[model samples]
Target: MTTAGTPTFDDRAVVLDGTLVVADLHVGRGTGGSLELPVGSNTELVERFTSLVDRHDPERVVVAGDLLHSFQTVPRPVDDTVAGFERACREAGARLVVVPGNHDTMLDAVWDGPTEAAARIGDTVVCHGHEEPPEQGDRYVIGHDHPTIEIEGQRRPCYLVGADQYRGSEVLMVPSFNALNAGVVVNEMRAGDFQSPLVTDTDELEPIVWDEQGRETLSFPPLGEFRRML
Candidate 1:
């Protein structure tokens, strides 16, 4: 079960049972570009991630892709952040797994050899959500379209929970934990983009309509005005 209320500004952590999955962790702070925003410093990301590791004491930590802003060139600060993350994992005794996202893939790079992509542990398969869904077992977890919710005119990046069909397996699309990337609106996306059914209050996948921009438009009434409308 998810805790109610928006997460506190300083609280950049999400706990699912005893396992912790941190999304969009840009290790290097100052490395800004057209694809990346330097809103939160690299030091801040490390501090927050480390703090969560210490407090939650998760057995495994998953970096849901986009560990670095640009994988084409590993800047000095980016390298430092990677080292820092490794050190933290060692100290915390937690295993760290990295997935490749769109930003991490180098431009014009040929796929001649094996790429460091998906990771499978236990019953779940984790990967960055750019490519097609994996053909793993029943349950799948991925992060590609950082998802968000526009509730009562307020928009915040959130994890999208749903089921999809891929080789007779189920899929769950996790929202981007990255602060910079804009998420795909869940209620307004085209039905074809997603392989699984759109999850609603009824706990079933249904057809979702999309606007011109391909955002999923939700039909729920405004949050505060609901009581007044009644």
Candidate 2:
């Protein structure tokens, strides 16, 4: 279990003070797989989310953003998928909250629950990271870049943690929760390549990968130093 101020990572989600935070669900994505298997993406999301909730037993579950994929419309299956998320959270006895992202233009159509431009949990601010957050906190947890790192010959999802990176606030950028979304490789990327205004210095950010199989987390050096090693 994590301490009150510390954050724990699991399956693209972070837990801090009895709250589970995830991002970039992109519920309506990958709809081309023969209408028969339309719920494929949804199944993956809900099942994984359920597992996370079960493990953490959080009092609250927060989706940092991109809860839906379509910008202009909300599909029927997409709506159903969202309901699944709600059901899982309800069953787990956790309050679900959403921080809408850029792609979540149709979020209101699906989610009628609590939302914030930037939600605060303790001293940390949770946001979608696509835009500047109105609120302030000592640390910021965001998800929008869907960062990844290539190790050996395989590509793996990663979290970018930067100290004093944004407005003097520590920043933690989680990977996209959706497995279907092949994330951006951040090995050589500079601050300009990132879409998040919160990311000011890529060099100061450290890439962290969670090894589910090994049940361990591997922390690499800051991107500036790690780049030379790569």
Candidate 3:
């Protein structure tokens, strides 16, 4: 179990007790364009993540998917970045498990298949959240949506936490740990479109919407806040 006052990093790794499972460790800096992406600086994100691993002293670290932005052709900078990440993980005394994402389809050549895509740690299933969630799991975590929160019209990546209303399963949508990718807005999406119908009106899953224009029109507070408004 994590002790009180234990410092945590801003990376998208899921911390259950003292165990940490991280996904989507795209280690690189800058965006596809000149504008700084909502995800932040990739190099800084990775460095901070590595720092967190060292501080948390987790048992294991799992990369659910999208370990790289693209596998078709890896840029030199990205390659170097991934190497640095691997080195850091090794130094931190944590075992790293990687799963592939659509963008990193080449990972399939190295790893196995979707069956191996998810890593089961205790009661929780960690996946990349691109396809349908596994059918036989009670608790699951994913990150494909790259969920973001709109606050005061500024969109920022954030985790979406909630319970599965139909299956009574606990679900956590981790924010993208990468700094170059803009995340998908939860309020603008339908929960059913990605996963199961188990997601319903519940206070467990809170959609943190972003307002890049300072309109604050898309922000939805925690589930409790929405319920209270209704």
Which is the leading candidate under TM-score? 2
* Model 2 Cα lDDT, one tens digit per residue, 1-230: 21138789888888989889999988877746432225467777888988998888999989999998778877788777789889989998999999999998988899999998887787788999998888888889999999999988789999999988888989999999989889999999999999999999999999999899987788999999999997
TM-scores of the candidates are 0.65, 0.94, 0.73
lDDT, model 3, position 128: 74
Candidate 3 segments whose C-alpha is farther than 4 A from its true place:
1-10, 27-42, 108-115, 192-204, 207-230
lDDT of 3 by residue, 1-230 (tens): 21222213245555665557666665432455332223435467667668768867776767777776654655556654566666777798776677665667555443332335677765666677776655446677777767665555767777676766436776667777765667665544555544434455445577643332563423356655654554
Can you write out model 1's per-residue Cα lDDT over 11-94, one digit (the tens) per residue? 333444445666565443243354333544556666767887787777767666666666656555555556666677779988
Q: Which residue segments of model 1 deviate by more than 4 Å? A: 1-19, 26-40, 106-116, 133-135, 193-230
Candidate 1 TM-score over all chains jointly: 0.65
User: How high is the CA lDDT of each candidate model?
Assistant: 0.51, 0.88, 0.60
Better of 1 and 3 by TM-score: 3
- Backbone clashes in each candidate structure, one number apiece? 8, 0, 14
Error of 2 at 108 (Å): 1.9
Which residue runs of candidate 2 sit more than 4 Å off their true CA positions? 1-4, 31-39
Clashing pairs in 1: 29-42, 164-196, 187-216, 187-217, 188-215, 188-216, 188-217, 189-216
